[model samples]
Target: KIQRQMGSSYHPEVTMKIQVPFEEFTLQIEGRADGVMETDEGTVIDEIKGVFKNLDAMKEPVQVHLAQAKCYAFIYGE
Candidate 1:
């Protein structure tokens, strides 16, 4: 619903894969971002996570989930 309002700037279910250089090898990271948006400011990566508990009880995003979002952003930037 909200995606439709954003028009062409919003891309839903975007899959991204990227490789990063490590100490002596390369690391590959791949995942799907719920939505990616392009705006005057910059690119936005949206990651959706299902909650089984009260949302209010969560003070911060899960570390793994946050890492995935960061990976998506890095892939897009690359």
Candidate 2:
């Protein structure tokens, strides 16, 4: 995937089927990031999205994308 290819520069790896336990139950979260990029600055979580329309049409979807990215960031501790 795009992330994997980009992460090759930083020797990135993928984490699959990550479980987050809560008080009531556990949430099963799955992700296949483009790749994890490590640099002198810090670790970067890459999320790739393909949209075939104007930004207006994609606003709602973009919000979802950002939410997913935020989750990924939280999971990765970035």
TM-score per prediction, in order, is 0.81, 0.64
Q: Over all chains combined, what TM-score does candidate 1 have?
A: 0.81
- Where does candidate 1 stray beyond 4 Å? 1-3
Candidate maximizing TM-score: 1
| Number of the top lDDT candidate | 1
lDDT of 2 by residue, 1-78 (tens): 654656555444466356878999998997766667777798887777887788776536668889888887777773
Question: Residue by residue across 1-78, what tens digits does model 1's lDDT show?
Answer: 777887789999898998889999999878788899999999988898898989999999899998888888878888
Where's the lowest-lDDT run of ten residues in candidate 1?
A: 1-10
Q: Predict model 2's lDDT versus the native.
A: 0.71
